[model samples]
Target: MRGADCASDHELVRAKIKISLKANYKSNKKHRKFNTNKLRDSSITNKYQQTLERHVGNLEQVGKSSIEGIWEIYKNAYMKAGKEILGCKEKADRPWITLDTKTKIKERRAIKTELIKTRNPIKRKEI
Candidate 1:
């Protein structure tokens, strides 16, 4: 099947191919993502520092101040304090989209899709 339609005798040939993609299903649940942006907030940073201090104060009970021992205690205290102050957040597909905004966008997308598929100019400007 010579489907090539070359305007010139030396024209390059091109191939047309069709490909389909399957939708991926990845649940946003289970794993919790931390909000690093919260660190920029002075309130949160202060809270974390205060909490770290409190947690580390109890580290004396863990015993001797070996480098490894101190490091371990500090790390644990930092992580625990961070989690306690900031909490676990599940990052969203669109972080800016609120429930109401999402609904509106979905509705708008449906309208736009219908306008394109049906070639309805009125539907295009309905919003």
Candidate 2:
């Protein structure tokens, strides 16, 4: 695996490209959960609907020449209004695990451990 031979005070060296296949592990992307329940609040819901109506009403052909342009205009206005009126909910990086669920998991693990240690039919049945 020899690189290019170069001799100079300031040398530019070239090396063979190493092609390798690596696992493309996806980052844990939490699904965005919009608080659509905000729509249940009368005031917020009304504001959102009004803002969206205004935005849509104001929308005109963006590119003027292409159908995609007009659609894009509508899409942008819709998204912008939704963002302004019903702002996206901030999500925690990790999903919340309730303390009750945590306690239940701990109990299950302890039971499994006890069943393994004793090899008792009763413990196995309990587990």
Candidate 3:
């Protein structure tokens, strides 16, 4: 395959890895233990478990690459979310600045102000 084709394949694999990581994260959060009820046979269970472990190890490597790719895609997502939640923007420019600081700050401030106004309403006394 050409270099471009190889790169595309790598990107596709990376995307799959990202999807798997997300699914595993959700599954781990939602369920304390993996559901192995389907594998009733001990041999099958052992095999399945081994496969899962190998897949998980591979996923970890992929996850690292995927995270790097994701950060490249939207390096400011965490920063933006933090700014929105914390009511403050980071002073330094993020490695990823697809959106300008001005825009991010403006949006974050607007959201923060809206949240505060909604959550902290003044009580009116009866006349």
Candidate 4:
């Protein structure tokens, strides 16, 4: 190949590289769980039903063209009613294991490792 004269003596190397990258689409949306247990109360149930009905009453008047649009309206109404009436359930922060149990577990692990490393049977038994 003839090198271009206008530049330095080193020949220009041309190459094509195709790189394929995996798309990372992470959704940070957390689904809210409504407190359905509140519906067991008669007054709360009546309030929820009335709120839901009021939200959906005007749906026919809006006259949405597409099925998706109608569905979106219905979904929004239901979500709004539930959010107002039921609210989100609070998450409990209780620990699964007590701190005392955790410390004992660590001690057990340390003793097990010591037993594994000891060469003499007597030391292993002592461990």
Across residues 1-127, which tens digit of lDDT does each residue of candidate 1 receive? Answer: 3323332234365779998989999987665556667888999999988998989996556676888988898887977886898777765585666899777867766654565477556765764
User: Model 4: residues >4 Å from true position, as ranges?
Assistant: 1-23, 62-65, 110-119
Better of 1 and 4 by lDDT: 4
- lDDT at residue 94 of model 1 (Cα atoms): 59
lDDT tens digits, residues 1-127, model 4?
3334332435567879999999999999988999999999999999999998898877556585587877877898889999999999999899999999888877766666576579999887777
Better of 1 and 3 by TM-score: 1
Model 4 misses residue 55 by how many Å?
Answer: 1.2
Off by over 4 Å in 1: 1-33, 58-64, 93-127
Q: How accurate is candidate 4 locally (lDDT)?
A: 0.82
- Pick by TM-score: which candidate is best? 4
Ranking of candidates on lDDT, top first: 4, 1, 2, 3
* Local accuracy of candidate 3 as per-residue lDDT tens digits, 16-120: 343334443334442123333445768656665565444344444546677666454343443343333333322566577556866876776565445445644
lDDT of 2 by residue, 48-122 (tens): 878877776643434454887677767767777767877778866865888898888777666555755786677
lDDT of 4 at 51: 95
Total clashing pairs for each candidate: 0, 0, 0, 0
Which portions of model 2 miss their true places by more than 4 Å? 1-19, 22-33, 59-66, 92-127
Error of 2 at 75 (Å): 1.5
Q: All models: lDDT?
A: 0.73, 0.68, 0.45, 0.82
